[model samples]
Target: MNSVFTEDTKTGDIIIQFPAASKLFKEYKIDFCCGGNRPIGEVIKSQQLEDKDLIKVLNIMYEQMQTTEEIDWMTMPLTDLVNHIIHHYHAKTRDLLEELSAFVSKVYRVHGERDSHLKEVYTQFFLLKDELEQHLLGEEQRIFPKVMEYDLNNSLETLEEARAEINILEKEHEGAGDILKKIRQATNDYELPMDACNTYRLTYLKLEELESLTFDHIHLENNVLFRRL
Candidate 1:
């Protein structure tokens, strides 16, 4: 089937153009966040992924995803992008982390005796929360304002500085992604045991939500905002 995107299309560009593509890429374990600069074909080949006409499959999925709710982040102004990131991702992440920390702590304390995995889950999550807190603080206080200023002035020096700072942020993104993968493994993809209580179930559910949010957050930063920088 003829598709709007080809195997030669960059992974990030494919995601930017098709909202359904991100879910497909994530389901295939394709790194559409930090490693999104390469072509989809190249990424698949490098990862040794074998798929039967994945591009056709994606095109079919996109046709069904007819909702107009998705934002045109690619063509959006840099300042608007920054504002959206802060409001949508940063603010929500802070609130989620706050609520999730209480849930994770309660689960780890109450159920860690029964399930050894909770210990690892607890460790990895707090580590992630800490890193994300610092990362958000850095972005809000220093990086984001610089980005808006750069956007406003079109100054080469500001652009260069933003680029340098975003390189650091990309490293942070990789670290967070790594921690997220570790959490997923520790929980075996948020599987719940038969003896699980309400808190335990809730903890796993929230973790899954956080995982999805973090993936979307990182993709927006690494693939969308950072590219524009």
Candidate 2:
């Protein structure tokens, strides 16, 4: 709020000034801690972030003056919240994967001969994308709907059924978290080479975004969704 850092300021500028903002960014797995020197616009574009939604959230934060009080993340229905995450975060992940896939392929084709690391990173990105896509589908088709069903039902039979489902979902969450960590590590914590081309830079940015989305995704399920169960 009150422009923690000016619109022109890079993420690095105000991260130190606004500990709350920095914490929120870190919770979302954003690179404000490490890549804070980059401009917000550049960072957002690299991460394939939905500018409109991000801006809306920022406006809400500005109005609230603190991240904790900005949005009642717990108040929303599980189904509605799941839908929002899918539409905003998961869909963006799909798009970023596609973009990254193409970007990596092109970069590898053109620069892989000179930079062997590109090939390795490209392979890792592809593997990570496929795993993440499968994970998203599982949540949408099975885990989310069942969780919502349980939340809506008050009967003893429903409660028993939901408990069983919740156990399976929690295991899936653990597995997903492991894969996400692998993805992060495979990208070398999303470090870009000094000679990185635009495509390489963009690819790292998307990886960072993916990490953030996964963090939020897991937090919602582990903290919010499971609490309801």
Candidate 3:
């Protein structure tokens, strides 16, 4: 066992404490979202990965993460944090879903004949995109506003309503996460084929980016924002 990384460390806690660990987890095809609570040693054992190799990578990642820009969102004012989420994650995800849908369709029309799995990827992406669209709409139109109101004036009525909405949103988050997991599985963790076209390659890259962003988005909501209420 490497001294730099402990076996008892939770995968999600690793990523939460060191954002750079996310890249390492993705490289290892570790499910750091739904299965994030597992100990690193357990995950490594399940995935049949070498502990020494993972520890080496994590030590390097820890060093890099120290140099990266860190934001203390927990310290931010509630209103500012909410605004940032709306503008950064919600708006960005909406645009990405649109662009990804078009790109996935084109790739499926062209390269999917040769790679039957592309069809499955496209199907999963469609489901994910639709789910996200509705999820974002609910947050923007209903849930977020209520959260803001509850933050401003902590009334029992508003608190109960927000809690109920958060419960629903958390379930929706899980559903969206499941769809992304399916897409990732079908695409072999978004690895491009040797004969992949430019568009095919771009589609996979974009999908990976989308997954990373969504994970961060959900983490902020579930761990940070909702916990405050």
Best by TM-score: 1
Q: Which lDDT value does model 1 have at 120? A: 93
User: How badly does each model clash, as a count of residue pairs?
Assistant: 0, 1, 0
Name the better of 1 and 3 by lDDT.
1
Q: For candidate 2, write residues 24-121 as lDDT tens digits.
A: 56645555533455676666677777544554465456556655544555677767877887898789878878877887788789888986766676
Please state the error at residue 224 of candidate 2 in Å: 1.1
For model 3, the local distance difference test gives 0.81
Candidate 1 local lDDT, residue 63: 75
Give RMSD (Å) of candidate 2 vs. truth.
10.3
As for TM-score, the candidate ahead, 1 or 2, is 1
- In model 1, which regions exceed 4 Å deviation? 43-52, 64-69
Q: Show the lowest summed lDDT stretch of 10 residues, model 1.
A: 47-56
Each prediction's whole-model lDDT (CA)? 0.85, 0.64, 0.81
Predicted structure 1: clash tally: 0
